[model samples]
Target: MKKENVVIITPCFNENTTVIAFLKQIEEVAGKLPFLFEVIVVDDCSSDQTLSMLQKFSFVSENITLTILPLRFNVGHQSAIYQGLLYAQHLDADKFIIMDSDGEDDPEAIAELVKFNDYDIVNVARGRRKESISFQISYYVYRFIFKIITGKILNFGNFCMIKKKVLETSCHTSFIHFAAHLSKQKVKSTSITFNRLKRIDGKSKMNLTSLVHHAFKSFVEYAEELLMVFLRIFILVILLFFGIIGVVLYKKLFTDEAILGWASTMTVNLFTAALVCVGFFVMGILLLNMISRRNQNKTEIFVKLAEKSELLNQN
Candidate 1:
């Protein structure tokens, strides 16, 4: 086969219900593109028939590569995506796009994503979402927390095109805190909005609870990136202390400086309490860094095993 220049990596987990239709739609969409392209489905050890579905397609489409990264257990969605991105990098695709196995993220938007090739990455903004009211509320809360943590406004959903280099670089990053990390590089980005469709086949793999967990983990993963927050807090604390001291000194100089008893005492106590909380939050992050280091070590071990397995199969 001619060298495949562009590829689409769709991460799957128990998506057997939608895999066939999704693959068919992807095929039709790719057929319209000008260059040679491949669709890689990274199966995340689905307990359902997802593996079998991918096997069937693998036998048929010469250009289609189905990578079954069967985890020892049920890895989360983001981990599955990272695995797909790794596969794409290994396959040497010039560019790659990640989409959900479910049809909600339209595969037809790939053309618009390709237009922003000048940028290292472009995320497709879901102009609309087909989600329950509760999910919508939770999503906005997560977004607010993300902005507070990262100090930047992030746009778009996970659906978008990324250069091969950005995909590889992002996978290795320790701060998995924000999806915007994919676009954090020096790259121009443009957004294209697509109407989010309701699921046609399988139920959404992500629920409210799972979404909450994902949001938390991503924030923790990117904790180190928020060092500036710590610095700013420290600076504010110093300034606040000085400001309070100046106020107290001025009052003493101008007034008789009498009768200010419990209120003044309580105010100082509150300032001290705030400082203590900030200290603990910073230390908690340090603890998290230790835990993340352990996770990265495990990931490295897995990568080694994957590499050895590949070498053996090649031989």
Candidate 2:
């Protein structure tokens, strides 16, 4: 039996404080796994000694490779990971594993991920979150909202293993695309519980603002999948508007003091106006989706730029 070609791709930005230790753990974990493995570290325009440190390691090790791309500006976390995954796909690896360099995701879990060979994408779900209780609660709540909006619940993050083909296809969609592409492929995907560890060296790259931005972007990016949500809301809006009017008219015709007065008229007008605004908003979103789909369907500009840049680097 041939050993599977496995590639580990990590996105590091200003991770000088933790990159060395992260690499060492990768080496240790690969030694225990029963496959031919390679490591690709993408330095996302780090201003610190992160790239320097990676270069120093790359020269000494044949199995380890490094590519540092100096972005015109910071492209955010998901785009950085997409770049690395594309690199991994170009190498023709059988499987691609993505992880963060902050040591929060345990490198040892690679063995367990590889064991789930049946799954085209294997995710390490955090069985135990190491953050504050409030943060954890908020995180799950966000996940629920995300599921409600996108029709897919993402319980994992960059710490997941995916098939090479899925990685290639998904990376082409958006600079900041999520792993939903695999799910859309109906690829065999599964999750395993893992206890998230605390960061040892540096602060988390994700701040509160960045996290919120990520959530909003995903909602917008996958809006097409949530059309049913808008449809349902639209129906409810129309029904509620008419229902209120019906109630007002019923009261005016039936009993007691005549209710068809200025207050009732104003209430009905306000409700009708609210429904009109919502209807316009939903229609606008649908129009944008139609435009976006017509534009490229799946291709993203940054991914193409990255591919071109990688080609130049090879030359």
Best by TM-score: 2
Q: For candidate 2, lDDT tens digit of each residue in 1-315?
A: 867778887777778859878888777777766677777666676677765566556434444444444433455677677667655566757788888888999988998887766678888887786776767777788789987777777777768888766776665654344554444556777888788888758466555566677776566555555655666666776676677677777887886767656656766675776676577667758766774674364422232433645533432
**lDDT values, one for every candidate:** 0.67, 0.68
The reply for model 2, stretches above 4 Å from the true place, is 59-73, 175-185, 250-257, 260-266, 269-273, 276-280, 283-315
Candidate 1, pairs of clashing residues: 177-218
Q: What lDDT score is found at residue 250 in candidate 1? A: 77
- Tens digit of lDDT per residue, candidate 1, span 1-315? 464477787777777758778877776666666656677666665777766655555424454444544454556666667766655667766688888778988878876765555777777876677888899888888888878887655556578788877776766663343365564666665667788878767466668998877776666655565655665776676676677667777778887876356547755765786687588667767866775685474252123334534532332
After the best TM-score superposition of candidate 1, give how far the Cα of residue 283 lies from its true spot, in angstroms. 3.0
